[model samples]
Target: MENTGSFYNRLTLQALAIVEGESDLIANLSNISALLNMELENINWVGFYLLKNDELVLGPFQGKPACVRIPVGKGVCGTAVKDNRVMRIDDVHAFPGHIACDAVSQSEIVIPLNIGEKCIGVLDIDSPDLSRFDQNDEQGLVSFVTELQKVL
Candidate 1:
């Protein structure tokens, strides 16, 4: 198994290449979601939630269908956006106001996407294993999003 450092390095390089010469938001998000879904192990869901009309609307994802909209300050995704910070929930059931988009999702990590100071959307990843995400994962995904933001 690849370590987090290497995994993320590879992910970043690939993501950069994927977005090269592609300026379309939806197309880039679709590819990013697909890349994360394909590269990450043990993840049940991978997607993007775009900020629209003061709420998060599902953008592109790979997995089962997910919630269509989430209000700011509600659920993990909303909370991440509301606080403009990254949220790594080890156990979704224990998270207050947790939205159960996937019944089997036990852990989740939400990375708020920002262009300069403006919050545009978020990158959400879900896993079936409890405590699936760690500090390393958080940092790694944050780096991934940082690179992703340049093309958005």
Candidate 2:
């Protein structure tokens, strides 16, 4: 099995190449979905939540059923958008006011997808294992989101 840091680095490089090649949002999202689902181990959910109105509307994803609309200040995705910070929770159950979209998800990492100074959406990843996401994961995901902004 690959270490989490190496996994993240590979994902970042893959995303960079894909995003540079595809300029369309839908194509970018589709490739991202496939890459995240296939490349990242231990991930139960890997998707994008676009900010629609006052909530997060589901965009492209590769996983089980996810929450349709997450308020701006609600769950991990919401908090990340509301706070404009990357939210990386080691244990979802231990997180204050965590929304259980997937009971099997023990850990989560949310990266705000930004356009200029404004956030457009969030890249959300969840794992069935506790403490699945680490610092390298956050850094890699943040870089992925930044590349996504330019393409989308």
| C-alpha lDDT of all candidate models, in order | 0.94, 0.86
Pairs of colliding residues, candidate 2: none
Q: Which candidate should be chosen as best, given TM-score against the real structure?
A: 1
Those runs of model 1 whose alpha carbons end farther than 4 Å from true positions after fitting are: none
Question: How much lDDT does candidate 2 score?
Answer: 0.86
What's the alpha carbon RMSD for model 1? 0.8
Over the stretch 1-152, how does candidate 2's per-residue lDDT look in tens digits? Answer: 88766777777778878878666776788789889999888999989898888999999999999889999999889999999999999999998889998999999999998888888889899999999988877777777677667767
lDDT string for model 1 (19-45, tens) is 899889899899989999999989999
Q: Least accurate stretch of 10 residues (summed lDDT) in model 1?
A: 143-152
Error of 2 at 63 (Å): 0.6
Clash count list over all predictions: 0, 0
